[model samples]
Every structure is written in structure tokens, then in C-alpha cells.
Target chain A: MEFLNASVIPYFNYWIYVVLMMIGLHAMITKNNLIKKLIGMSIFQTAIILFYVSIGVKTGSTIPILEHHHDEGHAETAHAVAESGDHHAEETDHEKSDHGNNEHAIEADHGIDPDHFANPLPHVLMLTAIVVGVSTLGVALAISQSIYKDFGSLEENEILAKIKQGGPGVDV
Target chain B: MIVPFDIIILIFLVITALISLRVRDLLGATMILGVYSFLICLLWAEMGAVDVAFTEAAVGAGVSTVFMIATIYHTRRHSSD
Candidate 1:
């Protein structure tokens, strides 16, 4: 079927990703509050994540888990075997039934059903981004908290006011 | 055959973005921003980017909006006095 064909152009996703990236950048630059800035940062980072994941996606792809189910009637297993087109599937299926704990070598190595192979790089990048985003959030929140403590308010204007006033005991 | 839904979704996404920028009330503007994300998510799904839609729906609509509102609550709710 043409629906399953991989020839369809991917245009809308690219536009959405670009728009979202711009929106996040606008928010980060325009917003004044520290927390809002962090939110903007998260939005910016998440936009890139969306972009990566979208670019990596292929139609009819499934979760990259190697289903260890050894039941002979499993359609997913049959599909995987049929798609992989190698004796490795039979080996996996046969080995999985007799020695359930021996799937590490088979599952980890190769023959991952070409039609269903997902680009895992995006997922890996997103995992890194999640960590980086949280770290940034933590630092921003700490700075906001410190600014609040020093100026008695969190507003950027309030902080600026204290700085402009040359108030004692308040460090800019 | 190409679906006309793409044009419709793109138009809606642009409209929400414009509305988000034009709105006066900060609260309303933030709400429109959420709608903007939703529309963009739809656009991603249309382009066969389900993973992108998933991230946008979760982070943009869900987390980003919450943080925006929370920041608003902590700061001034109204625009410049």
C-alpha cells in the first residue's frame, strides 16, 4: 500500500519544529522573570528534542524492545522473523524457548527487522537533553531564589531597583 | 493523494501564534500559547512525526504552560504598570 510506502514527504513536521524553536527563542529573550526564562529555556530545549525525534521517525516503527516472548503463536515474533529474513530469527525463537536466559547475545547483536528499525539516536539525545534541562532549571531556580532573598522580591524590576538605588547589603 | 488537512492545520497554527502575540491579558496570552503548541503538535502529527507530537504535547502544552503560569503567579500578573 502507498500508505505504508516510505516515499511520503516530511514537510509539515519541519515547519512545526522551526516555528516552535522560534517561539521558544522569542520567549527566552522577551520574558523578564527568572523562572519564565527557565521555562523558555525548557521550551527551547524541548523544541529541539521534538525536532530530533520527528526527524528520526519512520513509518510503521515500533518500540525497539526485543520481545522475549517465545510462544509459537505470537504474531509479533512471526512478523519479526519474516521481516528480518534470516536464520537468526529461528535461532532466537528456538533458543528463547529452550534457554530463556540466552537472549542477550541474539537480541543485542543484529537482524533488527529492517522495516521496523527505528533511529535510536534521537531518543539518546533527548535523554541527554532531559538531564541538561533539569540542570539548567535547577540553576535558574537557585538564582531566582537568591535574588528573591537579596531583594525581597523576584521581579526583575525590583532587583534592578535595588541595584539602581545602591542599596546596602544587596549585591547586584 | 495529498490531504487538504495540512493547509487547515497550518492556518490554525499561524492564527494561534498571532493571537498569542496580540492578546493583551497575560493570562489569555499564555492560554493562547498553549493552543499554539497544540496546533503545532497537530502539524507534526500530520507530517508523520508522532514522536515530535508526543514531546510537544507533553512538554509544550503540559510542562511549559504550567511553568509559565507558575512564574506569572510568582511575579506580577499584569503587564507593565
Candidate 2:
């Protein structure tokens, strides 16, 4: 069918991400062990990070750093051309060149396509998310350890049973 | 082009995820989860997310697995559910 055609190849990476995400979600929902649930959560977080990083990819593009030498060369050439021109013809040519240079300056200022660099925004944000995930995992593990000390088991059912029976130190 | 490599890595990822979930022993599952993290880290590096790949390697594969192992040391490894 149309969905099986060649056009779908470009988006195959997204399909893979979705599939991985769903697998992690299923594990998180159905898994009974606390550690298994944490593993599923980690898988889910990685999948989302993959999705964000994929969005910033551009074929044949380099990193997001300005090529100062290239820009300097272009500036010298533009200046040279501006200096060696007749008055009337120079006016028209200068106007066109000025417009082009202004557009390029704006693009460079915004880091939109400075020397074909990839977007750096997602990389920054995902860095924060990764740290947050680690901290959350640490806190959850600490709580799980406490649960084990108090209830003597990691299984959800056993923990629930202990709570239902009004075991000592089971106020929460 | 790059699609073939992506597909192969994705297949491995899916396999590791399923295995991690299917394993009965919590310790075994933790090890498999470590493998899953490693594979995804490679995939991220391949996709040009070097920063993310580095973090996943350190946090997901290294620290998290160690934390799980330590927790297992404190508690039982078998799952009754």
C-alpha cells in the first residue's frame, strides 16, 4: 500500500522511536517489580531523548560553530566590490548586496544556519533532562531500599499485604 | 543509506527490551536493562547526539545498574509477581 512505499523510509527512525517508547510503556504498566519499573522508566526516557536529538539532525551538516574565516573572506570581497564601482551602477549593486548581507547577519545572529551548523537547543535541554532523570532514579531507589527494610520484600503484592495487616511502622 | 544501520540497532534495542522484561530474576533483568541502555547509547551516538550518548552511558548503564545491584543486595532478587 501507500504506507509501504519508499516515501516512508525517511520517517523510519520516528517509527522505531515510537515502537521503543510503547515497549517501555508496556513494561512500566504491567511490571510488578519496582526495579523492573525503574528500568522501564529509563528506557522510556532514553527513547524520548533519541526523539529530540533526531529532530536536530540535518544531512551533510556540521556542528553549530561559526566559521569566522569564511565570514571574513566574504566581508573582504564585498568591500572590494563596493570600492571599485561607478556611482549609478554602484548604487543598485550596493543595495542588493546590502540586503543579502543583512539577511546573512540576521541568520548568524540567531544561529539559524551559521556555516550549516546543527541546532544546539535540543542538546542543551536534553542535558538537563538527563540529570533530572538520574536524580529521580536515585531518590526512587532510596525509597525502594527503605521499603525493603520496612516490609522485607520488593514485591508490590507483599508490600500491600503487610500494609493491609497493619504491620508495625506501616503508617504510610 | 543510514537507515539500514538504524534498523539493525533498533532491532537489537527491541530484543534487549523484551528480554529485560521477560526475565524472571530481577538481577538478570537489571543486567539486560544495562545492555539495553548500552545499545541505545550507541544509537544516540550514531544519530549525532554525542552529549546524550555520554550521559546515557554514565547514568543509565553505569550508575543505574550499580544502584539496582546494590538494592538487590539489600533485598531479595526473586519476583513473585
Candidate 3:
């Protein structure tokens, strides 16, 4: 009860993701069909990606587009913040309440609070992961098609049995 | 983010994931998987991962579903277990 009340409420996102990951793993392990296995693999991959993306979530923080102030004090604040790194740490939450304020061009990171923006690194990395997952799905599906063509079945046990038979067409 | 909204979407996501895996027809499962991907993308977008959501919508939900369907057309759709 204490665990549910205290820990689970705050971190329910992580908990649900863990449940999803387990579901994917179970499907991957117990499913018999080749396409089902691939679907499970995709589920597992997406769950992992979602977990990583959730890591970057900061409560009340806007998207990580640091809108430059473009005022006279901008350069001064940038230089001053660079000199005193500890100050920017405390003000990230209050300063970053807006999202569509990207009129100005790119500026130095010293002026804004780092915590004001959700971490971009994880999202970026997951983009690559998504690409790899899609490519892997395509290739694995193609290979499964080939497997079906060879053995005339997509069930794992049947494929194994056919391979064990060592027929003339059993190149696999 | 709104906590209740996030919770709702996450719950829906888990349900969709489970259904997709449990469905016997490969094509139906793939379609449910696409629904799962779209839910995740919506979650990402609401949580401020816009670019990540965009990519997921494009790759995970759109192209991957088509890929699975194309493969299904060539292979068998029913699963024994």
C-alpha cells in the first residue's frame, strides 16, 4: 500500500513502461508464428524507445527550443551566467513556460536554464533507434518471406521439423 | 503535462499493445500494432518530444504497418498459438 501510494503515483509512467516491456518479452518468447515474433520484437523495441523518451521528461518544462531574448541584457546575461554556472541551475523551471517563442535565431546555452528544456539527446538517439528498428523489421520480414517460400510454412516448429527432415529443397 | 491525461493515454497504450499481441490474425495484429505506435506518438508529442513523435508517426505507424501488410499478403495470416 505504501509502495503504491508513494512510489507508484509519482513514477507510474516508468512502471507502466516496465509492464509494456515485459509484455513484449513474453510475446517474443512464447509466440510461435514468425510474424508474431517480429511484432513482439517491434513492441519490445518501441517500449525501450518510449522508456528512453520518458527519461527526458521534466515536469512543467517546455520543448527544448531555447528562445533567445534578443535584448540588450542578453549578451551580458550570457557572459555572466557562463562565469557563474550555478545560478542557471535553479531557475530553469520558472523561466521556460512558453513554447512557440522561437522567433530569434540560435544563441548560446548560458542564458537559459538547462532544466527548462526536455533533454534532446535521448529523443535524438531514439530517432536513430526507430530507424534501425524499421529497417530491421523490413529485413526480417523479407527473410521470413524467404523462409515461407522455402519451407511453405511460417510456424517455427514446422520450419525446424522440415529442416530436420533434410529433404532435397532443405538448403536452410 | 496533465497527469491524468498522461495516465489515460499510457493505459490505452498498454491495452493496445496487449491486444495487438493477443490477436490471432497477423494482419489484424499488425493493424493494432500501428494503433499502438500512434498512441505512443501522441504521448510523445504531449510530453514535448515533437520530433520524436513525428518520426514515430512516420516510421512506426505508417510505413511499418504497410510493410507488415505487404508481407502478410505474401505469407500466411493465421497463427497457431
Candidate 4:
């Protein structure tokens, strides 16, 4: 809690994540070897995923679980406070309730309304990315294996050489 | 808090990148790259991107490392030198 009072620093972490993402992407783009490039691509993609998940986190907030029965007492007190207050206070509490309802709607649309707490969008997207990455890896490995078997070497140059030497009919 | 944590993560990331580049042994480089992914994952979590961190932790640190090492074994293990 003490550190929370310090200057706004939460945004700095995101900046570093972006920088790392760019560096990894640069490597993926410039690297020559196929496998090295794939590694770079993984790094690049992962940096962004990290960025997405981090955005959903809220300080001091636990997982969004509704304590409906427990919250009843608190809500009753809040209602009492509103009833005793002047019109402005009553209007303010009404506004707060509306805002809460709006948030609940958004959470429902996303189908991740777990106590109205975490942002579920990022989790859903990450799940998709994980599946896609694995599929891509499988395909890449299959291709690499086929290349090695055909050329008797993994280097791109060696494969080209074997292809040239065979004059186009030799298949490994 | 964010500033210092970010700076530290950045330094580790740079070191990992340099090592991955300068190291001649591909296997060693791939291992270092795995470490790089892990550090970056922490950075992401710090940024409030829990979902992203989860994926990075799983795919980047777990699957990708295995993929790289398996490829290296298939290609380079057979080589005598």
C-alpha cells in the first residue's frame, strides 16, 4: 500500500513490454535461418500476449467473485445511507448503481462474468493463440524434417545445392 | 514500481538477446532464448496483462523451447563435429 501512493509507475511496465516486442519482431524479420526465425516469431508474438493480459489486471482487486449473500448487508447499509442523504447524495448513489449495472452488462456479453471481476476477453484470445501457435509449430517441424531428409542437411544453402544438383527429379 | 521493474526486465532481455546472438552453439542459444521468454512473461504480468502472461508462460517458455531443442537434436545431434 505504501508503494501504491508513489508516483504513477504502472504504465512503465507496458512500455518495456512493447520494446521487447519490437526487438523480437525485428529479429524474426531479419534472421536468415528458418528455425531461428521461428524462434524469434514465438518471442515476438508472446510479448504482445503478455501485454494484453497485463492490461486486464487491477491493483487491490481480487478475482471478481460475487459475494451476493455477504454483500446483502453492505447493500442494505448503502441503501440506508442513500435514504438519509439529501437529493444530491441520492442521485450520486443512483449513478453508481447504474455504472455497476453497465459493467455487469459488458461482462455478460463477454460471457465471463465471474463475480464481475476479471476481464475475460484477454483470456479467451490467449486460448486461441495457444492453439494456433501449436498448430503452426507442428507444421513447421514437419517441413523441417522433410527438408532434412531430402537434402541430408538442415541448412537452407545445402538444400538448395541438392535441389540444383538433382536437376529437379530427385525426391527425398 | 513500474519503472524499476521495467528497467530490470529490459536489462535482462537485452542480455538474453546478446547471448542468443553471440553464442555459436545453437542449442545453448535456444536455451537462453527460453530464459528470455520467461523474463518477458514476468514483465507482461507486471503490466497487468495476466492472460498474455499465461500464454507466454505456456507457449513461449514451455512449448517453443521444446520445439527448438527437438529441432536441434534432430538436425545437429547426428553430426559428429
Shift of residue A56 alpha carbon in model 1, Å: 0.8
lDDT of 3 by residue, A86-164 (tens): 4344444433344212211122334556556666667788999999999999999999999999889999999889888
Candidate 1 per-residue lDDT, tens place, A1-172, comes to 4642443334554566577568768766776655545545655665676667565555665544445544444434324434334434444445433223223333344534433534444555565665566566655766666676678665577678878888876565
Kept native contacts, as fractions per model, are 0.03, 0.56, 0.76, 0.25
The list of candidate 2 runs beyond 4 A from truth reads A6-8, A62-116, A169-172
Against the true structure, what is each candidate's TM-score? 0.55, 0.76, 0.82, 0.63
Per-residue error at A109 for model 2, in Å?
7.8
TM-score of chain B of each: 0.89, 0.94, 0.96, 0.88
Rank candidates by TM-score, best first.
Answer: 3, 2, 4, 1
lDDT of 2 at A47: 79
Query: Which of the numbered candidates is closest to the native, going by highest TM-score?
Result: 3
- On DockQ, who's better, 1 or 3? 3
Alpha-carbon lDDT, every model = 0.57, 0.71, 0.80, 0.60
Best-to-worst order by lDDT is 3, 2, 4, 1
Instruction: For candidate 2, write residues A1-172 as lDDT tens digits.
Output: 5875655567766777788789889878887788777777877877787787777655654443334544445433223223223222423434534123222342424344432433445665787888888788888888999988988887787788989889886575
Off by over 4 Å in 3: A69-110, A168-172
Candidate 2 vs candidate 4: which has greater DockQ? 2
**Model 4, B1-81: lDDT tens per residue?**
165766688678867865674466778878888888788778666654455567778876788778878888887633211
lDDT at A121, model 1: 44
Q: Which has the higher TM-score value, candidate number 1 or candidate number 3? A: 3
DockQ of 2: 0.51
